[model samples]
Target: MKKTNIFKIAFILTIGLASIFSSCKKDAGPAGPQGAQGAQGPQGLQGTPGPAGSTVLSGNGTPTSTTGANGDFYLDLTSSLFYGPKTAAGWGTGFAMKGANGAAGTNGNKIINGTTIPGATDGSIGDYYLNTTNYLLYGPKIASGWGVGTSLIGTANVKYSGWATSTDPINVGYGKTSIRSARINTTAITPAIINSGVVLVYARRNSDLILPGGTTPLPFSYDLSVVENIKATVNFSLGTSVIYINTTTSNNSLYAEATLEYRYVVIPGGVAIAAAKNINLNDLQAVEKYFNIEK
Candidate 1:
């Protein structure tokens, strides 16, 4: 019996130990499913700045405000810059110097005619002289002796101060007729006969004349002709000729008067006509003299 009780006690002890072990022991339950992720954090602050850097120099020398001349070239050391010459007032931006002027050249030789006259004085191309005997101006010396100088007479020599006119009444026939006439008397001037002479004549009708029966006057038609002679029938005298006006009309009853205006000039001898050039009327002095106008 005691043996049986001891076996029962042993069995009861075994049962208690088994109960305690079972209470202490545990089994991992499949890592208990993963947890959810967390939210993102705010950004970090910026870092502080480092020390300042050194300056880099440019150009030559330093920068300066120095006075310069007109054409001087220079550089500013302070600002490391280049410039032109400096004057007393301030620096200049233009050329610094000017060159000297050159010398005048020698004149060329004077020539006249084919002869190359001896004792010819030094003179310019257009130098001229009036010949006392012939009363002509000569010069503009060329290789050939004073080439044909200008004629001091005629249109070239004399000035036409004014004009003179004369009128004559006439009756016209069917054909052309010498209706009226006038003359340019060479004796009228201080010198009767000029070495070189020139004359100008102009003619026209004074007014229109009506025919006997017709109310309207026929158109006046006329022409002029100059002749050099001493005939009593001729109107002009003493070296000059007479200028005549001839008129004509289809109507026989036409009566008209003709008028004439004329001027002339006389030139003495000695001027080289061949070498002389024609004078233009535009020359103020010549024109004034020709018109007999004072300037």
Candidate 2:
């Protein structure tokens, strides 16, 4: 009986061990939810830079070299032209930068400036100077030292003297009745003004300073101020510097009385400038307004 009991106990323990081993061999349960994704990879290396663009250049003459890179510009001062936007082939066609060659210019005179008066040795003939103290302009230095310095402001050196008149006309020689006139003293007239400056004249008549028709509107039907030579006409004998208020007839005749009044003006420039401005010599009021002339 004791032996049989021992065998039964061994058999029971073996059966329990076999059951536990079978559970371990069964298939695994569904996989748990996937875990969060892993971290990102590292950055890549940088790329190389590109080549530079063009440049500009200039020279006295044509370009002979291809040393300059593509898309460049070159100027030729000798030819006054431009060659450019260079290509791999070479410099492009050249085009003129200025107009046709002009006439040679006159030599320019030298100039000097100082607080003291300019000495003759300071500059050569035709040279100029400016006084720092008075702001006066001195020019075309001569063998002598500076003369009077001109003021840039105000009118030129023309003197504004009162009106001068001629003495009465007297018949002279064989041309007596046909041409009579008076000569007035004109020491004030300068040779320089007559040569290069401007001169203007205005005329009137009688002690009352009336028009040539003598106190009447233009185109007089009859003669006025003709006590003697009624056939003679009245006009001007210009060029003795502001002239003779002479009496002249048809183009074929002459003779004049010094019985008229006259006035004059002077400007500095070519006569063409006065004509170009379209001055009306007959219009006293207009002339006064344009040139600031005194009545």
- How much is the lDDT of residue 77 in candidate 1? 44
What lDDT, from 0 to 1, does candidate 2 have? Answer: 0.57
Top candidate by lDDT: 2
What TM-score do all the candidates reach, one by one? 0.26, 0.33
Q: Which residue runs does candidate 1 get wrong by more than 4 Å?
A: 1-102, 106-135, 139-161, 169-175, 183-235, 238-260, 266-295
Clash count list over all predictions: 29, 3
Per-residue accuracy of model 2 over 112-140 as CA lDDT, tens digit each:
78887676678777888887754556777
Per-prediction CA RMSD (Å):
24.2, 19.6
Q: Clashes in model 2: which pairs?
A: 179-255, 180-255, 247-256
Tens-digit per-residue lDDT, 62-156, candidate 1: 32454333445555445435554444555434331334567887765443332222224535555554443334445766555444334344343
lDDT of 1 at 139: 72
Candidate 2, superposed: residue stretches over 4 Å from native = 1-161, 168-170, 173-176, 206-229, 235-242, 249-256, 271-278
lDDT of 2 at 156: 40
